[model samples]
Target: MTVLTDKPESPFYEQLSGIVDEQILHLQDARGIFLLDKAHERYMRYYLRNVAEKPWNNHLLLSALVYVDKNADVRTIDELLQQVNVRLVDLFKIFHLSNMAEFNVETHMYQYLKGSYYQEHSDSMRSKLLALYRSLTYSTRKWVTSKLNSDQQSYFEQYLLPMPSYDSRDFSFTKSAKDLAKDTRKNETDVIVPLLPQIRAEGHFRWNQINRLRQTFLKACEQAKTTSMDLPLEFHYDEPERVGERFYFRLWDKSSFVLNHHDQFSASSLTSAYKRTGAYSEGNNRYFVEFVKAERLDDDEKAEGLWFTEIFEKGLIGRWNEFVDVTDDLIQQKRELLYSWGYGKNDFTENSFPFFSKHKGILTPSTFVSRNKHLAEGILFDVEPLYAAVTFGLLAVDIFTTTGARINELLQISNTRECIRKVKVEDKLKFSFYAIPKGRDEVEPFYISEQTMKLIQLVAKFLKEHYGTDKIPSVIYRGNRSHLFPEPKPYFFQYHESSFNHFAVGACLRFLLHGLNFESQEGKPVVIKTHLLRHAFATEAVQRQNLPIDIVAKILHQRDIEVTGYYSEPTPSQVAQSVSDLHDVISDYVDLDEAVLRSGEELVNELEEYKQKVGVFNNVLGGACTTNFVCPTKMQCLGCQAKVPQPEKKHELEEVIELSKDMEKRFTEMNLPVEVKKAKAMRKHARNELKEIELIEKYREEQKYEPHIQFKK
Candidate 1:
């Protein structure tokens, strides 16, 4: 057993009085020192043998084991120790260890601890020979669980996978050194510095200045990807450097350091928002009106407005009759009154801050989902206006929003996931929410799946990695002072999982119409928007060969058939593809050998017999045919050749077989491109040949093959 010499020292008399043999065993086993010491001793013995025999695996081990106490060689003097003096002198190259024994011990200890991994072996394997060594180390008897099983051994091995490899470079400090140079010149890194200062400059990133700089840097990133970046990169009131190499790295590194330093400033700003600290200590003890804040609303603004009633009344509640039946006029009237103070959408007095759609920023998968949830909860009143608002959102923002779901859908999904079931309605000040009851036996499940959940989770993971956990906002939303997810995020934004439907629709409309409400560089209305997706989805579904509208509706969750009908039905091309698939299946069935067909019949019967026990759907016949061989001919018994005996009513086996054969032939003919073309050509040829006697005789004979009739020529 591994001996732990660090055990508490006690008087001999006290130790003898308190100890029992079983208790001592338990201590050795629980403390785990028994196994470790045992393993170390065994390994040390093996190492010693290797040093004596191999002599070359490690020259240092050879010197230490063979010559430590011997006088054969002067070089082997390094292997010897004067109990303390010589060991100290020989171990460390740092600060002549000969001067201090303590220094040598520290150097040796440090080396022992700095393995590539902190804990490479498990407690069990550390002392495999515990039984043999326990007597030598301590007066105890102990046992442990059996050695780790295959699964457990694999688990431990996987756990150590993330630790530093032996070859891992110490780049953390090297990263910081270059990062410091970046901080000195934050802004103006893209463009060359002019000889004269046109305007007095401050270090703050104003919106206009920030916009220009963002564009400049985006160009630089693009240029870096394609061409050489020899230009000096600069930042706020800082010097530029040759940023061609490691363009993005030093920027992120320096930003991290800057954010770390500014954490106090951030906390203070949020705290001030909450407490109304500085400018609100007037005689009335009231926070007065100040500049309108887009990031935070004042006390008057915190009141969640009854947005539903206002927009619903203003021609917004036109789409879904489902909501109309669920909602009422009394609730909506109150919502309209709430909007009288001015909705956030039309108001631009806040210095042209984000005043469109559900919230600010480019249309993205994350933001779109959030917006969708907002709309569903009646945070925004109308789907129609919501559509228009999205036009503003996407068109105004620079980022592409088409990939995510409509913003309205995203919001509803988010609310479903986050809505705490029954008990309180304290959070939203003015916005109205419903209270849906659940049974005691039921547990509320999330509506936003992993696909949608990824939107916000990606944000948090990114923040933790680049900004550090300390810099993240305490809340998911930053509304009442403790804001979360601030701007200028340190990391490259992680990709979102949801579709940016609303954002795309909003942007496209603006691009096509050229800025309905907000000012835009492109004067015409934007062409794309979330609403167009409804059309796009319908058109694409209907035109795709073999894809049915009903199936597409199920995918899109269409409750109203009319909404689906607005999309055109399957085109001629789509029908052709469906016919093509059917032909392929029939071919496979026909090509099977006669014996294989018999085997298939037996298998089908067996499948049916097992269905009841297996809970298989008996209604579905196995694709294979079984023992029964229905005759393929379709003629009546007197005229049919395949039936053993014909039925009087003429539903004989021969008749059925013939009908089956004819049906297969007809379907097969439709599948053949040449046959289909020939059929069309024959129809046209007969129209031109109608005046001829031969053609007329042939046409009549074709229809005269009825069993009861004979044609007279």
Candidate 2:
């Protein structure tokens, strides 16, 4: 056995006692190659130890491991390399099954490789596994080349196994625009729009109700004592109509017992007394219900209980039926009240009710009830964390829908009050919050509506109250790359659970949507992933709000306008409308005959031919272009007569005129006569287009009154 005691031995080291060399374990060249940081060092050490267990004594396998270990990036080590470790173990098992002494490139390995690829049912998994295999082969070649002379390296490279190429046509992994649009419509109509009002109303109602009950519970705790002479303890409800008239109980050393409305001993409701009294035990720790009994008040009360059996035997079931009806009516009234506030039938079921048997059966009393002294002092202990979580999720939905932030960006929102700030734009105050956008190290402002900012502030106020702090406490994020020396950031999307990550945020959103009982147009249950909200925001901006693509791109924090275009492509209906509008714009500019407008197909064909002659027909700033080929005028559409100025794009043309004037001034100062002349010409063309549009608008206004005045094109 090669005993190496320089460092602490890994748990997996025993499995590879003799097969691996001590030098390979102490290899310093691979330190920077694979992340040997505190977060990932253990995984690299374990991987090396585990790979050494392969029965075959092959230098090629050792070389491949070292090569990949040194060359892999942090992401590959964190995510994909784990899969590679498992696959390598499986490959080693294949070598044993084939009875091979070492890894042979020309023998049974190729057949096994081909069969493994074909065995995978998922196209994506197959692609991933193939990439890993190719990586191993490429790394092995590189490692061999570094260890050998040029002539020897070239000869060794030819014998290496070739990797199969991935097919480009298989795009099942990608989502199309149509798929995104469908998701947007479903989420907008079924969940996001409907759930907003419910979250606000229910959150407020539940918060108030819980606080009121909490105060009553605290008062009852102080009033009822084991040393007190009061035989029967009492805890009154704030609103008797919601729960019941009152709860009468007697707390003993080991357990507690309940008394019914008539002050008669009730065994069935004893379960509630046990739970409530357990919450109020000394030191606030739960009391075990070992023994419980309702003591007799006097001889007369005991005699009344004994007579109930005779009354039941004497055909007096009518009285029992009356009591059942009254109980049912109270429950029905409570259900109706909840329904009026948009709560579904499922929410009031036995599974959800805190006092019910089913709820108590699965959940411990401590799970829902808080025993924190601060919460008790603030009269907020009765509020379950679930209600607060729902409120937090509501804030998340509002931020996502309004600001179009990625889920990670939303999770990383700073809890500082200064996170939300106001800036004056064109003399109007606009609100935006600073957050770390995806793929960026520094924070940027994400603009939100004033309404959203108010809701966020309200939630922050409640968070401070719950935490008993002037400022929300900062906690380190514990997901993904956070393990690598993470600093604490006061992320806003957290609750009692300090380590809120992407999955927890996702679960909160899904829980709210599921409770809302939303369904899609096809009657299937609505499923809203957080990323879908980003798609909805983009689609709404383009198709409904009609915001410019570049403006939407900037708001979405995308550097490339073309990438934003994928998110905001026009639907078929919008494209048809745009084409219809384009036809009218073309008629106003060109002297076309009636034959061109007689048929839809002929008009479309003519438009295509006209676009070919013009240069480019796509919609651009200021108006739609008439040309099909690249513009020889270098997209100075304002100066080109081939461009049609749109009334909707008049604002864009005005901006162009301003830009032209600024350019002319700069060019003149620099003594660039030709550049200044071009700028002047561009400004003149824009002014002329604006004048023509104004005259057309004036004529249209006059024609509306005259009715018979025909303006020539």
Candidate 3:
């Protein structure tokens, strides 16, 4: 049991408070004061020693202190103060300090009114403590800001302010893919583009092509091994980074004698796409297709020699045929294995997979699953496209579009965690889900549509059926390695074997959009990256769904509405259309003072066209501007003296007068002085503008058809 008492004037607290106040008033060196705060240090040490458990890790304080020291500036100081304040609040709560208490400077004792059960510090002490904390924080910030250089201050402010890290890999890759489509429009294709069709061809054609090529090369190598005594019978694929070189093979049609048996031939045989450069293969480990003059193809072509000789004689080789060496063979041998590659027919295997196959009940360990499971089963399933459609197709798109989630957030929905549930919202039950997204400290529940929920379920079911377990590997990679953290969870978004990371997810999205030939309204290939999906979701929520920007921010789990507002920024074309619309709406009311619109008599003819294009723009009913400035006053166009109402809009101006009167009536019912005062000012401005419009209308009516009255020069 703990005994609590208050003595109105404690000497220790009085000295501490006095020291803090004095330090705040005379603060100069922020770093020095922070280092010398014995009270704060003592509290932190005590907290670590006594109360640090579970969530209260000592590493947090250590990291925070290090971060503040490294970034010793105003922003860092401010962040430190916030952290300290939270910890202080936690400390106070732990001690059960609730009542009001005052620290008397003269008597050196804390004073408080006692309840029957216990004595505690009064609210005055709490107030003083908070005030002192704030003063110290403010002083420190002021000192640091005053001391910082312009660049440091600017960078600090820019980084400290809430903004999305938009250039994440998923976002950048989508933009790049869109750019590639643009290049295609200009009739310009990079070397990779031509090879893409070979590698990313429909169905499992690329895989089959690779397999046939590999078999032929190994057969040639085995023949050479029988003759030369030292060579591996088969070759293997290079690492993923070296995959590009394996595709660069030259075709040899079945006419010239190249194989031991003509029956071993396919439609065409492939030779090493690599050219035999006389340069030693020691440092140049990568394969490049070089076309050499036929010195009878340099003497070592076993099964592939005759094919190369025919191409060489026909002058088919050139300098422009260079490709990146993606050869799998890393070992250095005396004899070149470039001669050890030839083409062969693909070996047919029995197929058992089916088209549109359906399975019921729970998936088990015996599920015969592979990337090409459908094709292997000979079910006429286009497994390539289906693999993408099943893994990162509809569910991914729905989660991204509806939830405004970052890519990682969307991927965080694993079946291992019982995330999706029916939560009551607005007196109706909806399927909302939970995910502990990146940067967020804890699990946040996000409400999703029923369609999205179903899509998620479908993907979940597919993942289990494909992997034979609900527990798929988590997304963890370090440097050149993946699966570093091997703890398996039922991840919703993954391919046949890979646990989807940013790169895999991005590649799938690009492939899907490209395969589907998707395009954006901007006449460009649609950018389908994860962050773009989030932005698109936000934009649609505000522009189409009519959800509040703040609500969108909440759904996206953003810190502020300002960050969410970035997605809603208008494009140039959108701004241009808005200007056109505004011109059409107010053209009937205001006289054209600018020459751009009044250059010719064709204006009357174009009036109908403009109206047709803009339709009957009605944003003016609440007053509007096309410039997109965030006006301080909501009803800015109505009340601004520089933008007074024109005579032609008198009917609308009269409606504005009525609206202002109604607002005034409603504003009088409000008790808040500040809001009432602001509303009154707005109404007063509206009335003044109304009077001006009426006067202008009366003058224009009188002056009608009186333009003939001209002064003598």
Measured by TM-score, the strongest candidate is 2
lDDT of 2 at 166: 36
Query: Using TM-score as the measure, what is the rank order of every candidate, best first?
Result: 2, 3, 1
* Model 3, span 1-713: residue lDDT tens: 11323221222233333322222222222434342221233233443444243132222333233333333322333344454445444444544543213212112111111111123433333333334344443443443456656654453332121111222232223344444444432221111111211211121222222223334443444444355422212222221221222222221111121231235333333131122122212242221111112122223433221222332221111210121221223111101221121111122121111111112211101111211122111111112233444245445554554456776566566554355544222332234567654434367876554334544655655565666763444543211111112355556665555455554555444433333333433443333455665654555445433446765676678777797776644322221000000000111101112213343555445344433431111134323222112222244455431131434555675676677566766767765566666566655655654554443343333323111111111
Query: What are the lDDT figures for the candidates, one per model?
Result: 0.25, 0.45, 0.35
Task: Point out the worst 10-residue segment of candidate 2 by lDDT.
Answer: 576-585
**Candidate that scores best on lDDT:** 2
Clashes of each: 75, 6, 21
Per-residue lDDT of model 1, residues 1-713, tens digit only:
33434442222212322322212222222334322121112223443443222212122222222221121222112212121122222233434333222342223423422322225422222121121122211211111113334553343232111111221122232234334433222111111011001000110111112223233344434443455432222222111111111111111111222232344345654454345455222221211000011111223334222122333333222222123333556435433432332222222222111122223233211222222222222222212223223222321221111111232332222222123111111211011111111111112222111111222333334334433443333223211110111222222121122222332334323322321222112221112333333343343334522234554443344545565555433322221110000000001111123224345566456445443331111111111111011212211112111111101212232344455456556757678756545444433322222212222233223322221211111
* Better model by TM-score: candidate 2 vs candidate 3: 2
lDDT of 2 by residue, 487-588 (tens): 776666665637466656664554344344455545444456666666656655555445567767766887789877777655333310111011111011
Candidate 1 residue-pair clash tally: 75
Error of 1 at 162 (Å): 72
For candidate 3, the per-residue lDDT at 302 reads 35
- Which is the winner by TM-score between candidate 1 and candidate 2? 2
TM-score, per-candidate, Cα-based = 0.21, 0.46, 0.31
Q: With candidate 3 superimposed using the best TM-score fit, by how many Å does residue 61's alpha carbon deviate from the native?
A: 18
RMSD of 1: 34.1
